[model samples]
Target: MPAPTSDLASFAIALAEELPGSWTTEHHTHAQYPDQFDRAQHVWDMNLVAHAIAEHVLGQDAALTRDDGTRLYVVARPRHGEEFLIGAIAPSGIPAEAFRTVREPDGIAVPDDPVQAAADITVDLLPRYDKALAQVHDNAARLATTPAPELVVITLTGRDFHVSKPERADAVQVLLANGCVFDKDQGAFVLPGGDTAAQSEAIQNTAAQLSRLGVGLTVQPSRTTPALDTAPATAPPRTTAPAARTR
Candidate 1:
């Protein structure tokens, strides 16, 4: 794909979120057929990815496919240390029917075609999505005053996982930390779980950890933290629906 205007770092980070969504939309379409990863097609795909981000047309899974013998997953950091989307389900012993879907807040839906949907985010939509996202988060924080979740999760990428720079925080990251306890070392969240009184010690630990950065760890609880799925990276289906897309 063509090099989009997005910075390399931001673009790469966006992939963790985008690929899953786009895969869902492109899952069944022959548009991104494995055979089409040609030089020119590659450029086109890159451009589409950039356009999706620019347009805020963030589908849950845009390009995912669950066909005969293929599935995809994010396996590792490759040559550029860029996360590689490994479409290697067959060799990896995964079923091909694993990847397929684009989700709306309402439900899972498949995209018709990507080529037709490829459009840049208009200047208006970019700020609009950003502003709306910010407001939802603000509301969530306001609501946090009543009941607290078991966790307020934030997934961090890049070497600075410790989240040292306050301004560098993703808007979601800030929301998760707002009006809550925190810790960086454990890399786990202790967000107002159950009774905040019981977690006072854990909360202190979390607060201390957040004061500085450190290696990956859960600061909040000792329980296992989960990784996003290869498909849409969504929690398991809420009800019977189409197959979730991943990778």
Candidate 2:
């Protein structure tokens, strides 16, 4: 089996990156029949099988329809194990499927041909894929509303301050609107000058807004805060008490 062309591979990578979850290249070892000499071919065959299942059983269109209206395309990403993340760009949004555990016939002779194998696998797996996609959508929605931990970290860097882990998109936007410029090379948001008071106010406002949106913020301790390091004064030793006890 031939590997996916460079163009197809690039498109898949871009699509996967655009989506919310982490995705990796689809490798032959990740295929159901890893021992097969033509692993890429097997994957391609499986993709075709999945597309057919989507059309016939799931009532979905091909991942990609060519301008010529002759050929269709499907791209897939491999997870750590048997799961394959498959999708195609659509007019409205991405139509995707996740195949983790595929159903197979009981004691029926599985065909050696890749196309037939894909068909068999698809028949069992398509339903599972639909269910998984639904669950993924639900989880994503829940995560959006659920309060995240203090993922953003703010650190004082020389005369400026840098913000790290700005996980929330809205929080980043707030920071940017309030004069925080993202340093692409450093992968952080930088606030210029040593105006501690002004910086503090900005940080507070950003935190408050993000908190309202269920996003968390963590501010690094400022070195200028001597008060934080100062311990309460200990009482002087009772020298007079010692003399009185001796007398």
Clashing pairs in 2: none
Give per-residue CA lDDT, model 1, range 42-113, as digits (tens). 111111121121122122221223333222322122122322222212122222111111010111111221
Residue 237 of model 2, lDDT score:
23
lDDT tens readout by residue for model 2, 47-142: 223222211211111132234221122322211121223432111221111111111111112222323423543455334444544554554455
Worst 10 residues of 2 by lDDT: 238-247
Candidates in order have lDDT scores of: 0.26, 0.37
Q: How high a TM-score does candidate 1 get? A: 0.18
Judged by whole-model lDDT over C-alpha atoms, candidate 2 comes out at: 0.37
